[model samples]
Target: MVQDTRELNRKAVLTALMMSRPASRKWIAEASGISAATVTRAVDQLIAEGIVTETAEIISESRGRRAVELDVVSNRSFVVGVDLGASNVRLVVADLLARPLLALEIATPTATTARELAHWLASTARTSAGDVWDRVEHLCVGLPGAVSQQKRTISNAPNLAQIEAPTFLDDVENAMGRPVGFDNDANYALLGEQHFGAARSASNAAMVTIGSGLGAGLAIDGRILQGDHGLIGEFGQLPVGPLGTRLEHMVTGAGIIRRAAEAGIDLAAPSQLFASDAGPALKALRAHFDQALLIVLTATTVSCDPQTIVLGGGIANSLASTLDRYQAALEQNLRVSPRLAPAELGDFSGAVGAVVAALHKVYADLGIEEEAFVSLPGGDALTHERVQAARR
Candidate 1:
């Protein structure tokens, strides 16, 4: 019974903390509907546990007293985020504050299986962080496929054909000996943008990743639209032109190579297609790219009606100038043109998103629940000090 009460008090205090920034014991007690005495006790315990800290002394409205403000000690914990792209794997270790302490980007060979890849990532994370691995409470991986709602397995990925079977989350957990979380790379990128980049203030937005494959991650009504099947924004497979010509086939780096080859443009690699020299071959390639962007923009506008579209991935970086050219074509095709912008976080967006998701999950597992500041009746709830003083 005591343990239950303590848990309830902890939950209350945590909820109050989440609703606002660092708060005083009086404020927390009032917001949580707990007694000020109980709030003090809970805060003490949390501080001892390294989860909360006494941040500052706020001048009270009272004549001479000062109130101590408590804040969540976010630095006490850390999380690992990994992004598994078709051609590369990137890993980042960040503190609970989501500050990246270490980052590793390695090429992912097509021949490597999912298990092999997971092991490599776990080992790399362990090596990069050196002695700080023990503080890492969660590991989140963003893959290029549908993740099970159970958050355990990768269902399918056409690009990652080597992963024949579902790569279970337990595999990574076992390898790293830590809790693991999984999400789609595109979805993770969207979360990163919302939390830390261009879409931070945008309520409705879409992130289009133009890489080895083209895909989108969408946010609607302030929440990510993962859909029932967890495949809300698989835009790559969307039929853009002929029945066989998917959006990915028309707009991705791979698509550029295929189109350039068809046009007899001498391009050894997709990256070379955007070389500085604007020879006849490069000029012809640019025209094909402009046409592809028109189709992509039209599809994005019609499907989501987002406030803005953020372009990301390997292709976006190489073709920054081409994006301007595409933007002009996009404006011509769209009935209502949403703002088009390059991704703010660049290639690290996916890893950053994974870190945010991991941190949220870690807080959730610790029984920390966030409560809104406003009550349902549109009134401020009384604090514990007020209630206690009234009782006295």
Candidate 2:
């Protein structure tokens, strides 16, 4: 998005190098749509500035010659990803290349209020990140709620109704002295899947996390569709009840249990539900679950036409063996059979998606901005257009 042609050319070349590192100048030019001379100049300038490094000659099979290539220095930069759920919080420290060096989870603050959670987040980050704290240029926190883009405030989180601190985002910044980004957990999971999970190649995909509640994340045309207000994928909030314009009572995992209890059908956690398949609990919920899935799958299919739909979260991961049945039943209602896949990254999708978002901030401008882009691993498949780096 830089206006200057030369600056834009440098950014294009840098992005090309990021996606395909150790790339020759010719490759950089072809991938970035810059003239050979421009690419050469950009690469030369980048190398002279020590922002990019040139590796030893790599043998080129096509040309039958050895050629040196340029690559970003991923090891020098780092980002942190955080996933704060209703009960627990997960933190991951990743290098510029998005490789996780540390990951740990801890219980959330017991107070169950927004201010306490925000304070815990700030203090916990300082403790967990330890020596790597300063190196982390950006921090992305994912949770179950709608976040305002400009303010990074959680106006509404159905599960954590008590959390409503307007300056919570600033609290993290003041605590860490770095840029921070906030987003819903479902969207972060989708970004994680797109970058390193089952949806890596999918241009349009949907991810449904079935845990304490059911939530969804989506990718549209290769970008995370956060909508104008940053809350587009609230599948659990769909109005399925005829009683009023409110969230469907049975659209969540807790809701499922609540509805089942009211109907005199008892159920266990997801693992036990899938254990016998023929177990009475499984049998009892099968019809109801299928009907709800049909509604969800139909909505996702007709609305987004996603090529893949991923299932993840504590419940889904525990009940993964039974996914084929749900996929089969859901496909019965879809116009086209969208490939169903389980989340490869498992429960860590949200945290890793936070990592992906931070890495994206590193990838956006390379060195055009205040903080230079960091080194990241190769095999890139990342998208989230709104993750512009936080300005100082």
Candidate 3:
């Protein structure tokens, strides 16, 4: 009948099936909160379309007719996540459920043209993913800078200076013969936390990353807020302190070394500075964190009041021992305190976010609600007891 799976009942049925494999129509109805007739109708259509398969038969609890247990045919489709960084490129291929089938990482070549990058992507997928490449239904690319309006251009990435050609993204899409989505790497990292890490319950969150440079990914009302100019959540630009040091300068790896030098202390790395309990460098680093938080978190908290604030990147993760102080400092300064946590996913957050973005596109293309696929973490996700306790 070529029925579209957009109906609420169909979505419910699919979601129930995804959650519990090989379930009967009656079980799907109970789990999805849909009537048995609606589940049966949806299942029949899904099975016919090969989206779902009759896996087994079970005796009906009500002793009516033999119940046919149905499950999603995950192997029928695939999603691909490509993280294109200044230093490297990461590709992960997965089934419809976003379970990793293949993962590969390679140093990024100096490809000045988007067409070159596109060809590389296709070739790499074919070589690494093998027969699975044919089933890749959705793809997402993550990059260090903003994706322009309509996702046609990449901008503000100094590392990729040669990619000024506006036709780059369009050409890439054409080469691939399918739609392509772009994820700003900063926002994608935070989105990774929202879907799979600490910010699962946060409808609004500020994911601050202290790395080579500082930036934030703001999740507002369950969506990432990219500004009109694709500059939203660029918290690095926020200038604070007596000398007007920007957040980027205060919270980054280089910033730590530079600030410590000014204090007449030679610290090899953040790890070295964090090694001592009482030292001039340690005090300076703590002050830097405090000053930056006082400015950034105050502004972020009062403006948006994000339910949770997640901290990530090189500096934050490196200072694992003193993270409690970081959170406590935020609590001491802000008028309204929000939950604070460290990122669970470390280097691979952006790659995972690319996968989530690809799956999101798949759901939209299929006219299915997010509840049906849940490619990313949602508020309803079950988290570790310690994580939940820490948030409160």
Best by TM-score: 2
**Tens digit per residue, CA lDDT, model 1, 251-287:** 7777787887788776777777677786887877776
Lowest lDDT block of 10, candidate 3: 383-392
Listed in order, each prediction's TM-score against the native is 0.82, 0.84, 0.81
- Report the candidate with higher TM-score, 1 versus 2: 2
- The number of the candidate with the highest lDDT is 1
lDDT of 3 at 106: 83
Off by over 4 Å in 3: 1-12, 19-22, 31-35, 59-66, 110-118, 163-165, 241-245, 257-271, 277-282, 371-392
Q: In candidate 3, what are the lDDT values of residues 1-392, reduced to their tens digit?
A: 33543466677777767666668888888887787777888888778777888878887757567877787787888877777776667676767666667666787776546678767766765676678778888888777666675546767666665454677777666777767787577787777777777877788887776666666778777678776556776666676645777676776677777887887777787556555564765876777666775566666666567988877766667655665665676677764577777877665567667777887787666545664443342332222222233221
* Candidates by TM-score, descending order: 2, 1, 3
Q: lDDT per residue, candidate 2, 67-186, as tens digits?
A: 787777766778888888887787777777665667777877756565566677878777777787777788899877777785567755766665556766676667667888888888
Better of 1 and 2 by lDDT: 1
Model 3 residue pairs with clashes: 195-377
Error of 1 at 210 (Å): 0.7
| lDDT for position 186 in model 3 | 71
After superposition on all C-alphas, the RMSD of every candidate to the true structure, in Å, is: 8.9, 5.6, 5.3
Instruction: Give Cα-based local distance difference scores for all models.
Output: 0.72, 0.70, 0.69
lDDT ranking from best to worst? 1, 2, 3
